[model samples]
Target: MKPPLDLDQLQTFITIADTGSFTRAAEEVHRTQSAVSMQMRRLEERIGKPLFEKEGRSNRLTEEGERLLSYARRLLYLNRETLAAFDDQRLEGTIRIGTPDDYADRFLPEIMARFSRSNPRVELTVVCEPTPGLVDQIKRGQLDIALVTHNDARGQSEVVRREPLLWVGSVNHATHEQEVLPMAFGRPTCVWRRAACDVLDGMNREYRILFTSFSATVITAAVLSGLAISVLPECALRPGMRVLGEADGFGPLPDCRIGLMRGQTDQPEIVDALARHIAESLDNISVPALDDATGLGFGAQALGRGRRGTATILPGW
Candidate 1:
C-alpha cells in the first residue's frame, strides 16, 4: 500500500499553486517561506518525483506536480469536510467585512445572507468603502476581511474572479466620443483609476475627470445620466450601459482580479470558513454571467473590441 500524502503538506502545495509563489503562499497559509520550501522538498521526496521546475524566476509545476493537483484538492476538501462534519459545536463569531459599494451593491448582501444562514451565531459586520481605504483598514486591524481589487499582489489573498476592465458609458450619451473624454472615477488610491488613466495615457488620448466618486451607483448614474463615462469591470456592467471600445475611440484596459484579504488578527477558523464560502460563491458567479450577459465576456465573447485600431494596453500596469 502507498503511504498517504501529508494533508498539511498538500494544503501548502495547493496554496503555492493558487498564489504563484512560495512567499505569497506562506503569507496566505500563515507559514514561513523557508517552511513552505521544506514542506515541498519533503513532499517531492515522498512522491519520488520532482514537483516544480524553474522557468525564469517563477516556479512552474512539473508533470508530477500537475498530476497531483486534482488529487490534492480532493483530499484537502474531503479532509476539511470530514472534520467539520464530525464537529458537534456550531460556528459562531462576529466577522467584520469591508468592500466597495460597487461589490457591496451587487454581491455582498447575498453573500452575507447565505453566510448568516450557515453560521447563525456568527455575527457579520459589512462595511462599504473604496478598495484603497479597505486595504488600509485591514492593515490597521480595523476590519476582519476585505473584498478588494488589488494593484499589487500580496498576502494569501484568494483571487475570487477575473474580469476585463471596460470603458462604460451611458446609452444616451456620446461621452466616449469626446476629444477630451469626460470620465467618472474613484479617488486616487483606487486601482481602477490608475488603470484607466494608464491606458488612456499610453494611447496619448486626452481625458478630463468630470465626476469622481467612490459610490458605484453614483458613478453608474453619472454615466447613465450622460454626466460622464467611467471604467468598470465587465461583471459590474450595469444594464443599459454602452460599452466603449475601439469603435468609440477608447483604448482597451487591463483586467482586474477581485481578491479576498483577511485581517492578520482575524480568528482563523471563522475567517477560513467565511473565505471558503466567498470563494465558492464567486466561482459560481463566473460561468452563467459570462454566457448570459450580452456585453461582458469570458474571453470568447468580448464586450469591447476596437474596429479601427488596437489600443496599446499594458497588462497588469
Candidate 2:
C-alpha cells in the first residue's frame, strides 16, 4: 500500500499555494527556503506527479496540484477539527468580526450559521461598516477579523474570493438609456466607484451621481426605483436588477476581490477557527442566476462566464 501523506508536508504545500512563493511560504511556515524546497520535492515524489510548473518568474500549480489542493484543504481542516474535539476545555470567548455592509446580508448568514454550530460557546460580535472603516478597526485592534473588498492601494490582505464586477440597472427602468447617465455609487474612496468612473471617462460617456451611500440598501433602492444605474459584484445581485454590459455601451470593470484581514488578538485559536469558517463559507456561496425574461443577453452571457456561471448582480454602491 502507498504510504500516507505527511500532514506537515501538506501544510507547507498549502502555504506555498496560498502565498504564491516559496520564499514567502518559508517565512510564514517558519522554515528555511531550502527546507521548504526539500519538503515540496518529497511531497511531489510521494504523489508521483509534478505539483507546480515554472510560469515566467513565478510558480503555477500544475493540474495535479490543483487537484490535490481541494483534498489538502479538507484533510487539514478535518485534522484541526479532530484535535479540537478532544481538548479538555471547550473554546469559549467573544470574537469581534467586521465586514462591509455590502457583504453583510449575503455572506454573514452562512458564516455565522456554520461557525456557531461548531463553536456554540463562542460569542460573535459582528460589526457592519465600509471596507475602509473595517480596515481602520483592524489597525486599531478593535476587531479580531475583517472581511474587506480587497484594494492593493488600501493595503495588503489575503484574498479569498473573486468575481466579475458588472454594470447593473433596474429591469423595470430604462435608466441606461438616459443621455447623461444618472447613477448611484459608493463614497469616492470605493474601488468600485473609481473603476466605474474611470471606465465611463475612458468611454467619454456622460454621467452624474444621483445617489451616494455606503449602504447596499440605499444603492439597491435607487436602482430598483429606476432612479439610476450602478456597478456591483455578482454575489450581491438582487431581484429586479438587470446587468448592463458592453452591448449597453458600458465598458467592463475589473473583477471584485474579497479579502480577509487579521488583527492582533489574544484568542488566536478562536480567530483561526472563524477565519477558516469564513473562507469555507465564501467558497461555497453560489451566485444566483439572472432571469431569462429580463432580455439581458449580454448580462446573461457575462454571468455564464464567471467561475460558477450562476448568479445575478447588485450594485457595489
Winning candidate number (TM-score): 2
Q: Which residue pairs of candidate 1 clash?
A: 28-156, 93-122, 246-306
* Every model's TM-score: 0.66, 0.79
Error of 2 at 44 (Å): 5.4
lDDT of 2 by residue, 1-317 (tens): 88899999999999998878998999999999999999999999999999998878677799999789878977887786676667667689999999876577777887897787677889999998888888899999999999999999777788888887888888888999999999899999889999999999999999999998877678889988999989887666666878888888988899888899999999999998899988877766654545666645445555644433234333442
| Candidate 2 regions with alpha-carbon error over 4 angstroms | 1-6, 26-50, 152-156, 171-173, 286-317
- Model 2 / residue 98 / CA error / Å: 1.6
Q: lDDT of all the models against the reference?
A: 0.71, 0.82
lDDT score of residue 133 within candidate 1: 76
